[model samples]
Target: MPDEVIDCRGQRCPLPVIAAARRMPEVPVGTVVRVLADDPAAAVDIPAWCRMRGQEFLGSVDGPDGPAYDVRRTH
Candidate 1:
């Protein structure tokens, strides 16, 4: 299935994290989510959030717009 993508550019710390959290429930378990962010702190924050939430942090990459992360939720 096609994963959902959340573009959180220009948003700050908690907002980016919050946006991801909001959509995460809709993603279902085992599916991936691509979070595109450019807040600089997202690199650290996103991973940490994923860890705390028991999600899979598949890693991140530099996309054309900014940084993108591959996250998978596990129930």
Candidate 2:
């Protein structure tokens, strides 16, 4: 489970990552951001975004709607 959840279902590439980034600063280190995305590309892009941004890609969680990207704030 994550500290905060960013629902990006139906959203494409950059939106999911962008939304997550917006809320990343709100949490402390070691906390995770759960990004719910229906876009299939998000499976790879979200983790890539986290890596490019210096965050930790904690991995994925499956939901009824879609998969969630568990990203931990490292910076």
Candidate 3:
């Protein structure tokens, strides 16, 4: 399970990514942050954000409302 779960459902493209970015810094390194987003852009953006931010993208899974993207804090 993720150490943190950010719900971005009903939000649009950049909002989901923005929320993840905002929350990621609060978690400890090596902890997993799960982003629950319904926006289709999240599928692409989250992974891309991980790459750009130098974090570890742990892929995604289906959630109750949408897909949940997992990212581990590497720094």
Model 3 stretches with alpha carbons more than 4 Å out: none
- List per-prediction Cα lDDT, in the order shown: 0.86, 0.87, 0.92
RMSD of each: 1.6, 1.1, 0.8
Q: Rank the candidates by TM-score, best first.
A: 3, 1, 2
lDDT of each residue in 5-62, candidate 2, tens digit only:
8889888888888898888888898898899998888998888888789999988988
Query: What is the TM-score of candidate 1?
Result: 0.91
The lowest-lDDT stretch of 10 consecutive residues in candidate 3 is 63-72
TM-score of 3: 0.94
Candidate 2 CA-lDDT value: 0.87
CA-RMSD of model 1: 1.6
Distance from true position, residue 9, model 3, in Å?
Answer: 0.3
lDDT of 3: 0.92
* Number of the top-ranking candidate, with TM-score as the measure: 3
lDDT, model 1: 0.86
> Per-residue CA lDDT of candidate 3, range 16-69, in tens?
999989888888899999999988999999999999999999999996757999
